[model samples]
Target: MTDHVDVLIIGAGLSGIGAAAHLTRELPRTSYVVLEAREVSGGTWDLFRYPGVRSDSDMFTMGYRFRPWRHEEALGSGERILEYLRDTAREYDVERRIRYSHRVIRVSWDSDTSLWTVEADHHGEAVTYTAGLVWSCRGYYDYERGHEPEFAGAEEFAGEIVHPQHWPDDLDWTGRDVVVIGSGATAVTLVPAMAEDAAHVTMLQRSPSYILSLPRRDPFAVRARRWLPAGLAHRVVRWKSILVTAVFYRLSRRRPETVRRMVRKQNVALLPEGYDVETHFTPRYDPWDQRMCFVPNADLFTSLRSGDAEVVTSTIERFDADGVVLTGGRHLHADVIVTATGLTLSPFGGIELEVDGEKVDPASLMTYRALMLGGVPNFVFTIGYTNASWTLKVGLVCEYLVRLLEHMGRHGYAVVEPRLPEGGMATRPLLDFGAGYVRRALDRLPKQGPRVPWVTSTAYGDDVRLLRRGPVADRHLVFTARAPRAPVAAEAAAGR
Candidate 1:
């Protein structure tokens, strides 16, 4: 038996729930299904259990518009974020739409019927779904595992070696000499938390990453939020953060030298006297090339300043039984190792799509506004705010999607897809990548077209205007109404 849905949402994370809430409000009677790969629905927060996993962005803007962030601190741990998500899902009745442990494998578009046939592995068995449209809410980061480093004798190390992505619960860190590899957020966050409990924590990296220290509080802002209404406060903070992030991002983007100088000055002020600022704080790439690290508690700096954690700039040549051996012949002993390597980016549910007979390569397509894949339209994907809170961009994307869906329904259109003009298209990276999942997937993902509607804008204000105020035709959206099917006669059926 075949069951059809108006929209098939993949993943039940923050994006998926936001999409559902928006869609349900707009199309109350419309049926949509969310197929999740994992049994639980919190996505990143539910998956990553490493120590000190939390949001780097402030909670004021990070929290949903419908929800109030009651947290005292700006940065919240994984559990608090998870709880918020869980509560949101329940309140919105989004959990009921999710099918747990259903991993989608393929989506084939049937030209004749104009439907997507989704194939999936469900409960050790296969199942098929036919849907009019598909919404990909799966985040870019790989939840399965983080990237692993290949060090000689890595397997022979006696101490427990683990990646932060799949951190174990029972492992004790008391009196252990912990070594954390990599200089990304994962490594930066792990350093202070581990240093607090471990005998000594050493951060091993090939090169230093640009780190910025920001307070964990928005005192006056928080007070205003409490005194005033939620709507006014949220909007104010959201715009404020967006502007600050954009200014810094643009400075790093255009005036790299000035930004670098400022970064160096900050580093020198915070770092120990006679310590090489170039060695532990300077990054070769531009500030925003890779996501700049943010220290919420200022604990990372505190640890380094107090000599609780040693930051070493050297390559890991190999892993010995007791510890690590560096490329320059230096050796360090460690009782535990944490490989805080970055993540892999892929489409949600790992869904492979084919058109007619040819397989559709996502990398060849240009992403429009970093939302829709080049050729695919009528569907929306919520990737969330990378440099800021996940919910800020997600909420805006949801609002835009609801508007689009409403427009489609009013026009009696069954599908809407983006198509490039017959000639050809140009391509480039959506987000700059020196390292991490985003960089690794750059070649394997879609490219954006030139200019607005097709191009990506770093400005949140521009995005909001483009999404909310622009003319419908400006988006290159192709709308199609449902075609009437010819009726089959009883006599013809009998003959058959």
Candidate 2:
């Protein structure tokens, strides 16, 4: 049996739940359903169970605009984030609309019918659904596995090896020497958390990444909430956080050297006197080339100064029975090795798309306002800002989609697509991030044009003006109504 709805939302995570809530509030007449591949809600929060897992971005902007985050912490734990998502769903009454364990395999759009047919594996059986529009909020990471580099002689290691993406529960590290490989946010977080229980924790990295410390709880937010109403307080804190993030991003891009020096100075102040901050904290690349890792209250630095953790900057040649061997024949002994390497990026949740029996390659498509693809009709994917909190961009996208749908209904239109002109527009990589996961998937991901509305900007301020307040009936967006067809009986009789 096949089911049908006005809109089919994929992935019941942060984006999906927020999208549904927006629809319920803005387009109350529209019918929608959310399909989640996992057995439960909370997509990223539910998947990652590693120790010290928390949001790299502050919670003020990460939380939904409609729902004020009541918690005191800016960088909330994974468990708290999961609880927030669940509470949001419950508050909006969108939990009942979510169909869990529905892994969408394919989506086909037929122009004649002006509908999308989605096929998925639902609870060990095949299920089909049709909708007028398909909204994908499945995020950009491959949940099946993370990016793990092959280390020679890895099999010879007698100690247990672990990847943060698939961290095993009940695996005790008490009094064990732990070595975490990678200099990204995950490694920084794991180092401090593991050092508390482990005899010693070493962060082994090929190179350094820019790291900064932020307060776990914002005093300004706390004071505001205590003085003013909760709703007003939330708005104030959110905008303040957004402005601070935007200014920092702009400074990093405009004056790289100045920002670099400031970050390095901050790191030096955090570490012990005479410590080799240059070797362990100073990154070769310019600031914002890759996302800087943020630690709460200098936890990692405190641990390092206390002699509970160490940083090793070297290339690993092989993994021996006892530990990892460096290129210069130096060995780092460890009882447990954790590879906090990186993620494997997957666009549109790796679901295949077909339009009118023709396979559509996502890479060949151009991003339209960073929300919709150039040639795809009645479809929108939620991709957030890289420089700031993700929800900032996605929330705007959801609101814009609601306006687009309302406009289409008023105009009696059945399809809307962003059509690229056949002229001279230079194409570039969709994202400007230099992270390993993004770089590895650049060729497979979608392309962006050189100009506005076609390029995906990392600036949240620009996106707000373009996506939230911009006109829906833009010059490039082509809106068309499906031509009416004769009755089935009349056509059959005529053919006979």
Candidate 3:
């Protein structure tokens, strides 16, 4: 017999657990089941076991609004984050709802029944499930593989090459020279982390990414927790973080030069005097163009200043047996090479979607309020903001979805689909990020319209007003009542 639920949530990660918690607390009547492909509940936290793996965004905003983070640290380690997710799952009893090691492969929506049929591989067995609504909380990154760029003579390299996504547990490069490729968050994080044990760690990048220094621990959070209730204190800190980050983002866009100088000055203050801040720390683009890297307590700078780590901003010509040969003909020796390259973006967890026997192409669909897709009914996908903390937008998204569902139930609507006007709407790429991972998978992703409700803004304030407080009934959304089923006898006669 196929399992059935009112809502089928895919991926028991941060978003998934948060969504489930919301459903349990807000929509208590809704029956839901969470399907996680991995054995563990924490998705990204469990997958990435690299050294110094931590959240780039602060925990106050990144954390779920309902569950107040009691930790003193703003930047939490991967293990600590995993513990948080597990604790959340246990506290909300969401752990019981999650079916681990179940990878959903396909989801098909039936218009007549107004239900979705999901197929998944559960512990090497194919299992089927039906649900009134399908909620995809799976994040954008591909968990199976990271974005590994091809390097000439990479195979000729004698040393071990590793990717941060699948970091080897047994591998140790202590007292050895290491070279980390890529200038993204992973590279920056790895350099200082690995430098502590390794003799020397070199961050090899084609270009620099805007990096900022932040305190590992939040003094405000610590003080607030002592005086106020944990929940209230969390909210206070969260809002404060939101306001500051929002202002910074706005300033970066409005006054790029001013923000650039400020960021450069901050970096210079952390590093040794006369250090090549322009060459290594300075990015070609303005701040907020790409997501900025945050190094807690100026750890990366500390490592650099101590001569344990260094940065090399140049293109790689080829990988030699000893190390890498730069375009300028400089050869760096390395004992281990860590490919801290970017991630591969996969929408809807790379699951095949069909609507009434018609294969749905994600690229053909336009995003509706950045949650649901146009022409898709009874489905919602949670995607976080690129500019701000991920959970801030995701929390709003979950709240909005619950509101929409309640509205639909009261109206006796079986399906809700956003339909564009008769005239074609001008469309653009969904994400405005210039990151390599985003650019690599832009063609396969969904599109966004030029107008409101269709275009997704990274600004959390705008999203809160639109998604959290906006009306459920909109001009573009089309709701349909469920059609009556045929008689059993008639169906048998037709089959005979």
Candidate 4:
């Protein structure tokens, strides 16, 4: 038996919900379904239950277009984000479309019908569905597991070890000496939160990451947003945030040294007077080379200044009975070890596609606007901005996708897939700014060069123009429509 739908969306996360909302609203006549691996929505926000899980970016730009964020501060907690997602799902009536505990394991293209056959497990039972279009918004974060470094004697450690992704709910860390590994945003966030409860939290990082501490509230905009209408308030705050971020990104891209100098000055002022800025602040890579860390409430620096937390630049050789042993042969005692290492990104879960039993190597497949998988028509994947707000980029993608679907329906195309006819370059990893997850997936992922739409830039204005200006054209996409063929019986009868 086969279940049929106009569209089958994978993952009920931010991107998935966003896309679904657009489709349902614009194309109300189309039938659609969402398959979620987990039981609940909110994706990353719902999954990660760490101590200080919050948005690194401001909420003014991060939140959805239809919803205006009314939080106390721009940076919000995981619970707050989950609430927003839940509200969005409820408001759109998308909750009913979600099929939980249904993990999609295989997707096969049936060219004759111009549809994708998706197979998944539904409560330990096998089920299959066919749809004219398939969109994956599973997100980059490994839904299965986070990447934890295999350290020698990790299991031998007598102390409690935890990864930020799956933090214990009932952790009692009062007066415990905690050690956090990794220098990403997670490490910075966990340190400040742990400092309040832990006896002393020491951040054991191999290399120093450049951190910019900003106040939680946007002082000027907060007043306006409170008094003015939500629409006006959102526009004001969004523009203000976008302009400031764009300027800084432009400055960093053009004059790297200027931004570097600014970072040095900020670190010097934030840290103790006469302290070595190079020791705890300076990063080896260029500014924005890897993601720049953001600290809300100025908590991270305050923790350091108060001596509640100490940043140690050293490598973990192995885990001893009670603590971590540095590569330099120094052992630091830790009552709890928190590995805030990084994430693991699986592009379509490294799935291998076969067309008519012919293997389709995704590395060779071209990406249309860094979203769609080549050879898949009427499908759009929502991958957001690397530098700016995630929703800002994805919202535009959703809008474009809706318009594309409408156009396809009007044109009576049974199928539409982006074809890279030129095949000028092989697929490479999209972002190579040394973000740990990106670097890890470099060899196995799609390659993107610096080009219009194909290459992602920090400028959202450019993206808006590219997405909304006019219909995008590429030779690679092939459109197929059904046509009636003459009956074979007529020809045979005439010949006889």
Candidate 5:
């Protein structure tokens, strides 16, 4: 059948829930609905069932701005994060608005009607939602599957092969000789957590990644939450985290060696004496070139020191019945092979978009302030900071969204879309990242022009100026009145 909403939000994850909650506060009169692909809320937190699937970014910054992260966990576990999200939804009364198992397939915008026709699949049946605006909160990842490279003789491997994205609920990893492939966040998290009971966990990686150890509970935050009021305490801790992360990112970019040494010193201090820290911990690229992994309380290093887990930097020639065979002819015995390779990046939730019967190529359009895509009318997507907590940017977008909506309602504007300034602007990759996953999916993602309003920066300050405090009506944006449609025969008859 058909349904309509003033605003239709896709993906009832962290971003979507936050968007709804923001609307409930800022624009209470606005009607909206959240369409979720899965039966549960909490997107990534719900999808990933892997061991040690805690947030890479600190919870203070990752958590929503309106809602205070009442816990002391700087990096919260996946389950804990889910619980926090559930509480947020309940507190804001957002649960009833979420329509689970509504996987949106496509959205087509109609300028004539100033509405978007959204096609979705619900339990193998067709469902449609016509909305004035579409807020894409679904993240830029392939939820259907993760990125896994083909390894020769994998079929012959005797052990259970697992990918963390689709971790089995009943997989018995304890007391097993587990070999996890890759040295990214997933690998680092899995190696230590599974090593707790695994016979011996080995992390096989082609190269090393820079990893940092952060406190599970920040003393300052704990004290602030106890002494200060809830709102004031949250703001204090959040800004503190934001400033620290920004400063570290700045130092990482400006003085690479200085930051590198600091990380090395910390790693050496935590690991056992003469543990070959250089060989296992040193990354060829500078810090933040690829996203750095963070472990709470040096847990990864503790596991390494206790000899529960080990790191092997080598390329796999192939996989044999027993385990992985390195190019150097070294065979590592493994009863369980966990491929913590990475995720596949998918833009616009891999949903097809059409504008006035023409297919819109998202990769061709430049991102408008990293929230809305140019030339796409009444559409916005949430893509968070690669360097800092994701929700930091989400909060700004939500604020800007309310401002834009209020502006539109006041002016009786039916449609709004960003237009590139005259004399075509130069463009670059939206994400100036060096990660393998980003590099692999660069061609599929969007681009950014080399100036304000077009470029998507990682800095929170830029977002404050451009999105939060900035003017809603700008030269690059086009505002138009609603088009009139002929009355239907049924409506005419009913009126008579």
Candidate 6:
């Protein structure tokens, strides 16, 4: 069976829900449906059920621009975040518009019809849907599986081995030794959360990552909410957060040494005096190079000082029944081993895209304004900022999409595609981030030109500036009105 809609939104997560809400608010006349592969909304939040699962970025910028995050808490737990997403969807009355358990396998675009045919699998049954525009908010990683390195002797380990992507609810860590692999945000988060309950936790990493302590709740935000109006408060705190983050990012890029020193000082002050901060807290890479990890209210540090958690910087020689064995013959005892290594990228939600009967590779195309792809018509894939709150950039993309759709409606345009400039520009990885996940998938991910309308960045300020530039009318975009087509033979014969 087939169904049709004006716009087909892929993924019912943060981006998809926000996009739908934007359409519902700005372009109320537009018919749209949100296709969620999972059984419900809340993409990342719903998927990750690990202990201490929370956003690394602050919630002020992470929350939707239209809706004010009423709480003063900057970081939110995964469960709370999932609830927020569902609440937002409910508030927008978009709950009914979502079709859950619809896993999109393929999307084909036809220029003649100026529509996208989306094929999905619904509970092992094939379902098809068509739409004028296709929006991919499927996120950047695989939901079913996370990136897990094949540790030698992994199978030999007698204890439970868990990956944060698929955390088992019944698995108990109480009074047990837990060793978390990797020192990324997930590892840092888990170490502190599990330490409070577990007998002890060890963060096993080959190298250290810059982990900072940030307040769980923003005092400024709390003050603003208490003093100002709801809308005004949100705007004030959001902008304040954005500006501070943007400035810090600039400092990190231009004056890496200065930022490095500042971060080192912060770490030194927070950590216990004369503790091995250099080995555990200090990172080899500069700030923002690999995307710094933030721990709420120094929870990780608190656990470290309490001797409940220890950071061991060593290469895994092998995993024994007791725990991980280090290269230097030191064996770490662990009742449970958690692989918080990293994530693997899933470009375009791992969906096959065919344009006009020709298969298109996402890696070959350049990003247009960091959302739309060059040469792809009426397609927008939302990827968030790596250096800061992801929602800051995605929220703008949602608003920009709404503007484009409205502009197209007014101009009677059926399709809009971004065409490369006269002279083809040199391209590099779409994201310049140095994270292991990004570095591993650089060759497979999309490319970005060095110049505007083609370049991509984690710069939310730049997105806002470009968004203010215009509506759908852009020099680089190719907008076409639907061409008249001959009637079918059945209609023609009846008319004659």
Q: What is the C-alpha lDDT of each candidate?
A: 0.77, 0.90, 0.89, 0.79, 0.90, 0.87
- Quote the positional error of residue 170 for candidate 1 in Å: 1.5
lDDT for model 5, please: 0.90
RMSD of each: 4.8, 4.6, 4.2, 6.1, 3.3, 4.0
Model 3, span 218-263: residue lDDT tens: 8888888899887788889999999999999999999999999998
Residues 1-496 of candidate 2 have per-residue lDDT tens digits of 5677778899999899999989888887777888999999999989999999999999999999888888999999999999999999988867888888999999999898888899999888999888788999998889999999999999999998999999999889999999999999999999999999999999999999999999999999999999998888999999999999999988998999999899889888889999998888888899989998899999999999999999999999999999999999999998999999999998898899999999999988899988889889989999887888889988999989998999998998889999998784889999999999999999989999989889988888787888788788888999998535412322111111
Judge candidate 3 against the unseen true structure and give its global Cα lDDT, from 0 to 1. 0.89
**TM-score, predicted candidate 2 vs. hidden true structure:** 0.96
Can you give the lDDT of residue 79 in candidate 5? 92
Candidate 2, after superposition: displacement of residue 28 in Å?
1.5
Model 1, range 241-262, lDDT digits (tens) per residue?
6677778877888999999999
Candidate 6 local lDDT, 396-484, one digit each (tens):
88888888887887888888999998878999889988999888889888899998878996777777878745455679999999644
State the lDDT of candidate 4 residue by residue for 1-496, as single tens digits: 5666777888888888887787767787767788899999988888998989998888888888777788868888888988988888878767778888888887778677677777888899998877777887877668777889899998889889999888999887889999999889999999999999999999988899889988888886778877988789888888888888888877887998999999888888888777767877889988888888889867988998999998899888899899999998988889899999998888775545556557666666556777776666556677777777788887888877777777777787777877654646544566656788888876656656556545655578887787767565455467778423212222111111
TM-score to native of every candidate shown = 0.93, 0.96, 0.96, 0.93, 0.97, 0.96
Q: What is the lDDT of residue 71 in candidate 6?
A: 66
Candidate 6 residue spans exceeding 4 A from truth: 484-496
Report the Cα lDDT for residue 351, model 2. 97
Please give the range of 10 consecutive residues that has the lowest summed lDDT in model 1.
487-496
How far is 313's C-alpha from truth in model 2 (Å)?
A: 0.5
